[model samples]
Target chain A: MASFLRKNRPLLVTLLIVAAVLLWMTNRYEPKVTASILLSGLTLGALYFLVASGLSLIFGLMDVLNFAHGTLFMIGAYIGFTAYANPRLILNTLPFALALLGGAQAGRWLGGLLPARFKQRWQDSSFLVLTFLLALALLFIGVRGFNLEKLVAATATATGGVVATDLAQEAAGRFLPRIILLAVSGLFLGLGLSRVGTAEVRQRPRWTSAGVGLILVAAAFALIPIRTPGEVFLLSVSSNVRFVLALVIGLLAGAGLGALIESSLIRPLYGRVYYQLLLTLGLSYVGGELVKSVWGTVGFYMDIPAFFGGSGDNCPSPNLWSWFSDHCQSINVLGRPFPSYRLFIIALGLAMFIAIALLLQRTRLGIIIRAGVQDSEMVQALGINVRRVFTLVFAIGCGLAAVGGVAAAPFLGVNLGLGLEVQLQGFIAVVIGGMGNYVGSAVGALLVGLARAFGDQLVLSGIHLPWMDGVVRMSPSIARASTVLIMALVLLLRPAGLFGKKD
Target chain B: MTNILEVNAIHTFIGQFHILEGVSLTVPQGSITALLGRNGAGKTTTLRSIMGLNPPREGTILYAGEPIQGKTAYQIATRGIGYVPEYRAIFRALTVEENLRIAERSKGDLAKRGDLIFELFPDLKRFYRLPGGQLSGGQQQMLAIARALVPENQLLLVDEPSEGLAPIIIEAIVAALRQLAAHATVLLVEQNFRMASQLADRYYIVDDGQTVSSGQMADLVKDRPLIAKYLGAGYAGAGLVPAQSTTA
Candidate 1:
């Protein structure tokens, strides 16, 4: 018994602490309030886990501390919001996408036409510069060509002067020819870029990739009918389907952006930690500003899907078990009404955790990742291309963060500050749990979430200590600082974090 | 025999420190050529250079008659060369099975060599499910060598496999390498001159990042003065001659 206690001291201590907290909470507040607070804490923890898992995995494999990870989250929320509310905004921008693609392809073709001597001397830089110039010219022409006043007037006339969020759909049907042009340009661009990316590795890019891209573009065009009287707007689709579409679009956008950043920015700066930190930090700020410009400065709440029932304060059932049969904005949990979406967030977090764990444990790719974390050079010597793996891992990490953003959009509301806010908490959780340990990050996130929730409660209703006569009151700022305090305390006791190994 | 690997006047550097100034050597096909050198004599660096880990800046490495100096480590490894780094360098957190699985160049490579690996190092089979860190030092060295063999590499670079093992373990390793040499070429780095003389058919002595001498192992065993000069006086006095007949 003594040996067992000594061996499982940490686990025992954690259980003891949890019991003490629960006992203290039940004494101070009603069970319903306590249950609600704990559920909320779990919801927050789910969001943090979604962000931190990817952060931890990326850091473990690449030794890169990505400051722009939060930016990916912000982008996810914006993309999801756009997909949910105004997908036509994206479809309308295809011409601009085509212009950029055309410019890039033109630059590549020009580079290919260059003499071998000149090409060898300049390498791909000249092509990149030419691409940049051509893209700038295209952007200038596109801006000059787009008459916004005429578009707004046309939209107003089409919508009978009652312009709504779905205004862009009115113009979508006219861009069919442009869509075909974009698809063709995208095919050539995809082929050329794949060649550039895999030339060093000597991998031949299969036609299936281009075929898939074309099919997807064609499918998107088919799915959303071309300005038919009844089926013109994507918003006409069910809200739940749109929400699912948002999730998919957000994930793809985040992954694509991640791959681009890794191949272009992070690849050249490997082994230069400070430079990478600087670059990513600068990118986060740029990303935040870009989001503000695109989505506007003010935050907005996304409407709950119809599957969860219409948004209102009406409660038909008071029993927690009734949630399974009834669809309501809020569900009764232990006599307290809690947002059912928060429960969904909690479920998503747990699901993501299990999925990530399975991916890391059961797959062949997982073995390579675990081995790469220990010694990448040795992994490379074993015949695996670590660079491609790095890019793939980075993309996966960003995709996970984006998923978190989409999940958080309904509960927390979409905003520019959301990314950085969750990112800070995610970093704290990672530090507290132990850098590069995903399970530890999850636990750390839960701890932080619980601390924040309880701290907020304490500030609202001052805690009464057994030793003290009166209720001990403190400033509300203490609640905000509670996570840092817990982090500091954990660091003081276990410097490498709860799960981190000492170097 | 035709050379499988030839290093010509390679100059290697690790973060601006010139480690291998003018190291050069050639390994004949199907032979276990031992690289004999003292500590910090760039013997390990020479192996790393051929593996394209720390690629040499001023030399050409011809592998199977093709230059591979500018290639990445993975690219060179895919060309059928395997490396067993000094001190094992096994992924400690991973299981023994996982370590071998990650080293496989093609799918089912491990399954193809499972019998051969277990036949050579039966202890690895016993510890297949256990983490590499849980294994003993000698077991880790076995796992590391076993990892290199999973890909059916044409050439194997074994660096200081006997560095931290007992005499019994070293004997087992030497026997395994003797068997391995019949199927693949090997470039072995060893401080144990006796082990080198026993397993190797030819030997090269590296001192101060340069190959000072090259000859048959029998000739090297006879040259006590050369051993005393390049290796320390301690090695020469420690009965550096082979205890048994050298492997062909």
Candidate 2:
């Protein structure tokens, strides 16, 4: 039993803390409010987890302290927000894409109809020629016939799309072309992808497929029906598609930015701690300033998609799916209405945690990474490219931070100060969890999130004690301060952190 | 025999301290060459310089007649030179199997090497799933040697294999080295002159970061005063122990 305790002390301590927090919450608040707060806390924790996981991973593998992690997060949020705000781009790009699709189909048809005596190269050449002709036709259509303003005006006039009642019809009319265009682009995209696939096997140039994809994207962009009020902000687009697209783009953007930073800035100064710290701190400021210059000083409200937002008489969220619409309203857990979005966020966090765990534990690359974390020189001597693994780990760490930023955008809104604030919390979480420990970072993040929620929400005004007059106050400052307090307490108790191995 | 490795007048520095000054050495192909020296004699530095870990400021390291001085450690390793450092730098957190797996350049060679390693040190196979940190000192030394061999390396640079081991463990290690020398060229550095003369065909004595002596091990055995002059009187006594025991 003592041996067991020694082996799993971190796990047991964490469970105990969680249980204590839960008990305290249950005793103080009503079941419904407690549930709501718990969900919110979990959701918040998940966001912190996303950010902290990357920080821990990079710190563990590379031994580089990344202060600029938050900047990547902000960048991801901005990218996702920008993508989500632009439904018009998707809608506009649709009509011009028809020819590209038709061209690929035509190429396939020609390939099938060609004489059996023709050589494989000749058939392939014919296919290429047909695709090129169709692309040319698309270019013509884009340059001459495609006028997004005229198309929008025409749709508005013909469909009587003025009031909110006809808005759905107008949207339907706008989306129909988008759907068709998507299908067309998708078809050509598939053809291009297949070419790439064949090139991999045959050692052929995959440029033709790439060219097809570029043309398709260009055609799609040419058809975008510009909207004045709608395309300017994230709140303008309430569609689930826009939200999903934004999230994916945000993750990729974050990952890309991470790769860029690692290759350009961090690569040369791998083992130098002071230089890395100075460079990363300077980068954070530069990145924050760059964001401010581009997006301006004003904060943009992160609009929760209709499917994920509150649905009431004041602003009844109009979801295409009735199942989502049904669940969009607050879920009653005693008498209080608990936001389901928080629950969804919590679920996302759990999924991400499991995914990262599986990635680190299951894959051969992960095993190599883990070994590298322990003794990098040995791994290198073993003939593994430890430098490449370092880059990959750093990028992944930064990408996860970006995921946190984008995920938290709806709750916190997009602002210039967002990065620094989240980064400070992430650092605190790292300290609380233990430096260079992944699981500790996650546990620390959840604790911070829970403490913040409970600190702000749990009030002692109603309860009356027989022994003495009792009152406890809660404030927003207290909520923020709670993270610092928890970190201090954890440090006092376990200097190496709960899970940190003694160096 | 053709020389597999040639270190030509290499100068190495570690943070303002000149560790190796004009250190030159050669290891012939498919032969065990021993580097003999006292503590802090730059023997380890010489091996590290050859591996490109502390790439010499001035000099060239030619492995298989290709210039490898400017190459990275992994590049040097991938080119068929394996290194077992003095400390036995094993990934202590990883399992014995994982340590071997990470060292392997090609997965296809694992089973063949695994068989050879198990045959050499059966204790490694018994604790295959155990973390390297949990292993005894001798086992760690064995694991370190086994790791270097996993990549099917042509040359092996072993530093202080018998540094701190019991007579029985050292006996096993000496036997393993004899078996391994049949397949790959070995550059061994040893404080134990007894083990060194037993395993090595040739000897290069390094003193003050320079190669002080280089000759056949047979000649090194004959010249006790020469060994005493370079490796200290204790090492000379240890080196000629087998011969004295045979006479007895």
How far out, in Å, is residue A295 in model 2?
A: 0.7
Candidate 1's C-alpha runs over 4 A off are: A1-12, A94-116, A124-131, A142-233, A310-321, A467-469, B239-248
lDDT per residue for candidate 2 within A1-503, as digits (tens), equals 99999898877987898899789668866787787677677877888888888888898888888999989888777766656653333244334444445444433433344355652554356664554455445444434433444433322232222233223223434544544444454444334323322211211224564455456555544444333234333333345777787778678767767876785578777778999999999999999897776566776766777676656663322332442546564555455656566666787788888888888777768878888878787677667777778878887888788877777777788888888877877888888888878888888888888877776674423333457567545545767887898888888988988788888
Q: Candidate 1 chain A: worst 10 consecutive residues by lDDT?
A: A153-162
TM-score of 2: 0.78
Model 1: chain B TM-score relative to the native chain B? 0.96
Docking quality class, candidate 2 = acceptable
Q: Write the per-residue lDDT of candidate 1 for residues B1-248, one digit (tens) a residue.
A: 89999999999999989999898899999999999989999999999998888988899999999999868899899999999999889999899999999998889999999999999999999989999999999999999999999999999999999988998888889889988988799999998888887888899989999999999988988888998899988787654643653434
Q: Which candidate's TM-score is highest?
A: 1
Query: Model 2, which residues run further than 4 Å from truth?
Result: A87-238, A310-325, A459-468, B243-248
